[model samples]
Target: MESPGRYRYRPANTLYAASHDWFSPYLSRPVRELLDAGPHARSLLRSPRNVDVCILFTDIRGFTDLSRTIGSDRLFRTVDACIGRQIRIIEHYDGYVDNFTGDGLMAVFEGPDMTDSACRCALEVVSRALPAVRYGEAALAPIGAGLHRGDVAMGTLGCESRLTHTAIGDTVNRAARLTGFARGRDVVISERIRRGLSAETAARFAPVQADRRRTDIDAIAPIYRSRCG
Candidate 1:
């Protein structure tokens, strides 16, 4: 079994020796096509592309406390179980896991309705992934997430011997920062996401002011939140 808290993409078929570590097995077919083009395609990893995408970051609340309370074995088991289930949920929503962040993970959703898809995926994580595991008497009840939609520079960064594919730019940073404001089972989102939502979907969230005085992104715009029901 894979070690706890370690997230690596595994494709369904036998691993290709050339791109085994460079590409994620969970990458969307469209992304895979782009990567398979040729050596020139590798440049795209460094150049930021203006593509519509929703970035979702989910982390376990009070993880430090939980880790101390639970033994290492149990903690690892809990994290592995929760993250594994979350990855499946993301795949179901046409999204892919980008990387694992300690007790949490980041996923990217693309397509016409990427924001909407990301929101649904975040909700599902709160609903399913949290309840799916229990360590001793404690349940993973609260999972905080932040979702944002905008253009991001998606590419890989590393030297000749190693390559890591990831998304960067303000959009990605904003999504990650927004997670700091999330509490309990809250799914916090940005105005960029709100702008892309339809009326019905927009109604699901309640607006709240986020303290961004310390961050680089615009703080004037309001952040939104929705509780898992």
Candidate 2:
């Protein structure tokens, strides 16, 4: 057995370390605050709850095409750096990252201003990824984002040894489908999201014209596109 001194319980040290640990960045601010107060995994995820939140999904437009032009090593680094920047912007707007898909990410925003926060974050994400800064021999591609707001089941899954915190339901699906519809440097928002925005914010987005392409998708009609970026 290892010596007790090698890893003795130290509340202060553990709290400080936990706040800066790799896993900490993945947690929502409220969850991090809870863990900081009582550093316990059980308490952190004991109860599942339904929450009203804005979900945003972003993906690099034409990523598959971009991938073919770059080496794997450079592609990996470029994507990592790009995602890191987007995550910072998400947190800045009081949002939490849900998951990352190699060239994109899903984030959640809650609270009274969740709609505004998610909208602003999506716009910024598009703008931030617009500049093709060199990453060795490759560059990050411009991204497309989508936002929707609705109720979702938020909780942890899996056994004690390995748990994953995620949100599920039609709300999540719609947001992702909206992302698929977004064009490069565009922020596509569902009607629900557009309705939630403040007047001034809502005015910034233009209604997406209905076309055969969009009409074919389920529940994706009447979306709005923000071209601010």
Candidate 3:
């Protein structure tokens, strides 16, 4: 937890427009009139759009094969449980559950010293799912996670019936790619997010044994996070 004295913040007074779009205008109001001068705000407000330093994706491995074997009714139920456990873990770490896409989730953590926290969140998310899963015997196989810390365009992606307010950039793509690279329950964090990690946390991750032959077995992108040192 950060000290309360570290941050100062105020919410831009928001008003819903006649057109259904919303707007907030900064006026002559004193800085003391702020919304959530919480400790997290100091770091969250650093980048106007992207206080987000991490984007993690955790998907049940072999979902496709399972779907074919189990049939739709049982499969969707299984996927829901798998994703639900991950969402709960992400929220516990002060991370936002951006969206749940089928069996996976995109989580965004906004707070101070986020790089270290994000790494911990990813580990926790994968750890929690193992115990939460139950019959019809759904288990998390090869939990994959991608992490990146940087500025990303953030906003409501749509309106009315459908919407997603999320982080968008190559950083996000790269993280997802890292997840895709993971094998046998690998965490698969990227170079960028790895660099952001505290020295102690960085020590936890091991290097990907170089695949010089370019084999099909470990193909996705480059880089992967296998274990904690």
**By TM-score, who's the top model here?**
2
Pairs that collide, model 2? none
Residue 44, model 3: lDDT of: 48
**Candidate 1 residue lDDT tens string, 1-229:** 2212112232323323345555545564434544543463455445655666899999999998888787888888999999999999998998888888999988989877777888988987876787878967966658999998888877666788976777777888888988888898888899889888878778888998767675655688789998454
lDDT of 2 by residue, 85-132 (tens): 888899899888888877899998988889988898888889975464
Ranking by lDDT: 2, 1, 3
- Over 4 Å off, model 3: 1-52, 137-140, 159-161, 209-224
lDDT of each: 0.77, 0.78, 0.61
Angstrom error at residue 78, model 3: 2.2
- Residue-level lDDT of model 3, residues 88-138, one tens digit each, is 677677666666667787777666767778888887766666565655655
Single out the weakest 10-residue window by summed lDDT for candidate 3: 24-33
**TM, every model:** 0.81, 0.82, 0.69
Evaluated against the true structure, the overall lDDT of model 3 is 0.61
